[model samples]
Target: MQVFEDWNQKVKKTFNATNPEVVLTVSEAGSLLGLTKDQMKLYVDKNKLTKVPIMRSVHRYLLLKSEIDSIVKTR
Candidate 1:
Protein backbone atom coordinates (compact mmCIF):
# COMPACT_ATOMS: atom_id res chain seq x y z
CA MET A 1 0.00 0.00 0.00
CA GLN A 2 2.74 2.38 0.93
CA VAL A 3 4.71 1.59 -2.24
CA PHE A 4 1.64 2.16 -4.38
CA GLU A 5 1.00 5.50 -2.74
CA ASP A 6 4.60 6.55 -3.34
CA TRP A 7 4.41 5.56 -6.98
CA ASN A 8 1.16 7.44 -7.40
CA GLN A 9 2.67 10.56 -5.92
CA LYS A 10 5.70 10.27 -8.18
CA VAL A 11 3.51 9.88 -11.23
CA LYS A 12 1.47 12.92 -10.28
CA LYS A 13 4.62 14.97 -9.77
CA THR A 14 6.02 13.93 -13.12
CA PHE A 15 2.78 14.77 -14.85
CA ASN A 16 2.64 18.15 -13.17
CA ALA A 17 6.24 18.87 -14.07
CA THR A 18 5.64 18.11 -17.70
CA ASN A 19 2.41 20.20 -17.77
CA PRO A 20 1.85 19.12 -21.34
CA GLU A 21 0.20 22.04 -23.06
CA VAL A 22 -0.69 21.50 -26.69
CA VAL A 23 2.13 19.11 -27.44
CA LEU A 24 1.56 16.66 -30.28
CA THR A 25 3.60 13.69 -31.42
CA VAL A 26 4.96 13.55 -34.95
CA SER A 27 2.29 11.09 -36.07
CA GLU A 28 -0.40 13.27 -34.58
CA ALA A 29 0.96 16.38 -36.21
CA GLY A 30 1.15 14.60 -39.52
CA SER A 31 -2.45 13.51 -39.25
CA LEU A 32 -3.54 17.01 -38.45
CA LEU A 33 -1.56 18.36 -41.41
CA GLY A 34 -2.97 15.74 -43.78
CA LEU A 35 0.50 14.39 -44.46
CA THR A 36 2.18 11.07 -43.94
CA LYS A 37 4.70 10.62 -41.14
CA ASP A 38 7.57 10.66 -43.67
CA GLN A 39 6.27 13.87 -45.18
CA MET A 40 5.94 15.33 -41.71
CA LYS A 41 9.60 14.62 -41.09
CA LEU A 42 10.44 16.29 -44.33
CA TYR A 43 8.39 19.33 -43.35
CA VAL A 44 10.21 19.56 -40.10
CA ASP A 45 13.55 19.18 -41.82
CA LYS A 46 12.61 21.82 -44.36
CA ASN A 47 11.71 24.21 -41.54
CA LYS A 48 8.10 24.45 -42.72
CA LEU A 49 7.18 23.45 -39.19
CA THR A 50 8.90 23.53 -35.84
CA LYS A 51 9.18 20.92 -33.13
CA VAL A 52 9.81 20.97 -29.43
CA PRO A 53 12.49 18.60 -28.20
CA ILE A 54 11.57 16.07 -25.59
CA MET A 55 14.19 14.87 -23.08
CA ARG A 56 16.88 16.31 -25.30
CA SER A 57 16.39 13.40 -27.71
CA VAL A 58 16.64 14.14 -31.41
CA HIS A 59 14.31 11.31 -32.25
CA ARG A 60 11.62 12.46 -29.85
CA TYR A 61 9.94 15.68 -30.82
CA LEU A 62 6.57 17.36 -30.29
CA LEU A 63 4.82 19.94 -32.32
CA LEU A 64 3.07 22.91 -30.76
CA LYS A 65 -0.69 22.52 -30.95
CA SER A 66 -1.11 26.24 -31.31
CA GLU A 67 1.01 26.20 -34.44
CA ILE A 68 -1.13 23.48 -35.90
CA ASP A 69 -4.24 25.44 -35.08
CA SER A 70 -2.84 28.49 -36.79
CA ILE A 71 -2.09 26.53 -39.90
CA VAL A 72 -5.61 25.20 -39.93
CA LYS A 73 -7.01 28.66 -39.54
CA THR A 74 -4.95 29.95 -42.43
CA ARG A 75 -6.08 27.14 -44.65
Candidate 2:
Protein backbone atom coordinates (compact mmCIF):
# COMPACT_ATOMS: atom_id res chain seq x y z
CA MET A 1 0.00 0.00 0.00
CA GLN A 2 1.11 3.60 -0.56
CA VAL A 3 1.03 4.15 3.20
CA PHE A 4 3.58 1.40 3.62
CA GLU A 5 6.12 3.15 1.41
CA ASP A 6 8.94 4.90 3.24
CA TRP A 7 7.91 8.34 4.47
CA ASN A 8 11.44 9.51 3.70
CA GLN A 9 10.62 9.19 0.00
CA LYS A 10 7.91 11.79 0.39
CA VAL A 11 10.43 14.43 1.41
CA LYS A 12 11.51 17.05 -1.15
CA LYS A 13 14.91 16.54 -2.76
CA THR A 14 15.67 20.25 -2.34
CA PHE A 15 15.17 19.90 1.42
CA ASN A 16 18.69 19.06 2.49
CA ALA A 17 19.12 21.47 5.31
CA THR A 18 20.15 18.70 7.69
CA ASN A 19 23.08 17.55 5.58
CA PRO A 20 26.21 19.51 6.46
CA GLU A 21 28.37 18.43 3.56
CA VAL A 22 28.26 20.45 0.35
CA VAL A 23 28.35 18.96 -3.11
CA LEU A 24 29.42 20.39 -6.47
CA THR A 25 28.55 19.52 -10.03
CA VAL A 26 31.28 18.38 -12.36
CA SER A 27 31.46 21.70 -14.19
CA GLU A 28 31.69 23.72 -10.99
CA ALA A 29 34.34 21.46 -9.52
CA GLY A 30 36.24 21.51 -12.81
CA SER A 31 36.30 25.29 -12.74
CA LEU A 32 37.79 25.29 -9.22
CA LEU A 33 40.46 22.84 -10.39
CA GLY A 34 41.24 24.86 -13.52
CA LEU A 35 40.26 21.95 -15.74
CA THR A 36 37.53 21.51 -18.32
CA LYS A 37 34.58 19.30 -17.48
CA ASP A 38 35.89 16.47 -19.64
CA GLN A 39 39.35 16.73 -18.13
CA MET A 40 37.89 16.71 -14.64
CA LYS A 41 36.16 13.44 -15.40
CA LEU A 42 39.50 11.95 -16.37
CA TYR A 43 41.17 13.43 -13.29
CA VAL A 44 38.51 11.91 -11.07
CA ASP A 45 39.24 8.47 -12.49
CA LYS A 46 43.01 8.84 -12.31
CA ASN A 47 42.89 10.17 -8.75
CA LYS A 48 40.10 7.82 -7.61
CA LEU A 49 37.87 10.61 -6.36
CA THR A 50 34.73 9.60 -4.54
CA LYS A 51 31.78 10.26 -6.82
CA VAL A 52 28.38 10.76 -5.26
CA PRO A 53 26.23 9.08 -7.90
CA ILE A 54 22.78 10.36 -8.68
CA MET A 55 19.83 8.04 -8.23
CA ARG A 56 18.44 6.20 -11.27
CA SER A 57 21.25 7.55 -13.42
CA VAL A 58 24.68 6.73 -14.81
CA HIS A 59 27.51 8.90 -16.15
CA ARG A 60 26.64 11.65 -13.68
CA TYR A 61 27.91 12.35 -10.20
CA LEU A 62 28.78 15.02 -7.63
CA LEU A 63 31.98 15.72 -5.77
CA LEU A 64 32.35 16.72 -2.14
CA LYS A 65 33.38 20.36 -1.80
CA SER A 66 35.69 19.62 1.13
CA GLU A 67 37.60 17.00 -0.81
CA ILE A 68 38.18 19.39 -3.67
CA ASP A 69 39.35 22.08 -1.28
CA SER A 70 41.91 19.76 0.28
CA ILE A 71 43.22 18.82 -3.12
CA VAL A 72 43.57 22.45 -4.06
CA LYS A 73 45.57 23.12 -0.93
CA THR A 74 47.84 20.14 -1.52
CA ARG A 75 48.25 20.47 -5.30
Candidate 3:
Protein backbone atom coordinates (compact mmCIF):
# COMPACT_ATOMS: atom_id res chain seq x y z
CA MET A 1 0.00 0.00 0.00
CA GLN A 2 2.82 2.33 0.82
CA VAL A 3 4.48 1.52 -2.47
CA PHE A 4 1.29 2.26 -4.36
CA GLU A 5 0.90 5.54 -2.54
CA ASP A 6 4.45 6.52 -3.32
CA TRP A 7 4.00 5.62 -6.97
CA ASN A 8 0.82 7.66 -7.13
CA GLN A 9 2.56 10.67 -5.65
CA LYS A 10 5.33 10.39 -8.22
CA VAL A 11 2.82 10.13 -11.02
CA LYS A 12 0.96 13.18 -9.76
CA LYS A 13 4.19 15.12 -9.60
CA THR A 14 5.08 14.12 -13.14
CA PHE A 15 1.64 15.04 -14.40
CA ASN A 16 1.76 18.41 -12.72
CA ALA A 17 5.13 19.14 -14.27
CA THR A 18 3.83 18.63 -17.81
CA ASN A 19 3.16 21.71 -19.93
CA PRO A 20 0.71 22.17 -22.82
CA GLU A 21 3.35 21.37 -25.42
CA VAL A 22 4.63 18.39 -23.49
CA VAL A 23 3.70 14.86 -24.40
CA LEU A 24 3.33 12.05 -21.88
CA THR A 25 4.32 8.42 -22.01
CA VAL A 26 1.81 5.58 -21.67
CA SER A 27 2.55 5.13 -18.00
CA GLU A 28 2.21 8.84 -17.34
CA ALA A 29 -1.08 9.03 -19.22
CA GLY A 30 -2.37 6.01 -17.35
CA SER A 31 -1.38 7.58 -14.07
CA LEU A 32 -3.25 10.80 -14.86
CA LEU A 33 -6.36 8.87 -15.86
CA GLY A 34 -6.11 6.38 -13.00
CA LEU A 35 -5.88 3.55 -15.52
CA THR A 36 -3.43 0.75 -16.13
CA LYS A 37 -0.98 0.87 -19.02
CA ASP A 38 -2.92 -1.74 -20.93
CA GLN A 39 -6.13 0.16 -20.35
CA MET A 40 -4.56 3.34 -21.73
CA LYS A 41 -3.52 1.44 -24.86
CA LEU A 42 -7.01 0.05 -25.16
CA TYR A 43 -8.46 3.54 -25.01
CA VAL A 44 -6.16 4.60 -27.78
CA ASP A 45 -7.01 1.59 -29.89
CA LYS A 46 -10.70 2.18 -29.43
CA ASN A 47 -10.34 5.79 -30.59
CA LYS A 48 -11.94 6.96 -27.36
CA LEU A 49 -8.63 8.69 -26.74
CA THR A 50 -5.87 9.94 -29.02
CA LYS A 51 -2.08 9.98 -28.99
CA VAL A 52 0.78 11.33 -31.06
CA PRO A 53 3.51 9.17 -32.51
CA ILE A 54 6.88 10.18 -31.14
CA MET A 55 8.80 8.40 -33.90
CA ARG A 56 8.32 6.07 -36.83
CA SER A 57 7.14 3.36 -34.46
CA VAL A 58 3.41 3.35 -33.90
CA HIS A 59 3.92 1.84 -30.47
CA ARG A 60 5.92 4.84 -29.35
CA TYR A 61 3.28 7.46 -28.73
CA LEU A 62 2.69 10.48 -26.54
CA LEU A 63 -0.44 11.98 -25.04
CA LEU A 64 -1.10 15.69 -24.89
CA LYS A 65 -1.80 17.25 -21.49
CA SER A 66 -4.70 19.24 -22.94
CA GLU A 67 -6.40 16.12 -24.21
CA ILE A 68 -5.98 14.48 -20.84
CA ASP A 69 -7.51 17.45 -19.11
CA SER A 70 -10.47 17.36 -21.51
CA ILE A 71 -11.05 13.70 -20.77
CA VAL A 72 -10.93 14.35 -17.05
CA LYS A 73 -13.38 17.22 -17.37
CA THR A 74 -15.88 14.99 -19.15
CA ARG A 75 -15.57 12.37 -16.43
Clash number for candidate 2: 0
Listed in order, each prediction's TM-score against the native is: 0.65, 0.74, 0.62
Q: Please list the residue runs of candidate 1 whose C-alpha ends up more than 4 Å from where it truly belongs after superposition.
A: 1-17
- Where is model 3 more than 4 Å wrong at Cα? 1-20
Could you report the Cα RMSD, in angstroms, for every candidate shown? 6.6, 8.2, 6.3
Residue 10 of model 2: what lDDT?
A: 24
lDDT of 1 by residue, 16-69 (tens): 467766566677778888999888888878866776665545576667777877
Error of 2 at 31 (Å): 0.3
Candidate 2 lDDT for residue 17: 51
What lDDT does each candidate get? Answer: 0.68, 0.74, 0.68
lDDT winner between candidates 2 and 3: 2
Model 2 agreement with the true structure over 1-75: per-residue lDDT tens digits: 345643222222332354576677777789999999999999999999988776656777778778899999998
Candidate 2 global TM-score: 0.74
Models sorted by TM-score, best on top: 2, 1, 3
Q: After superposition, how far is residue 73 of candidate 3 from its true place, in Å?
A: 1.6
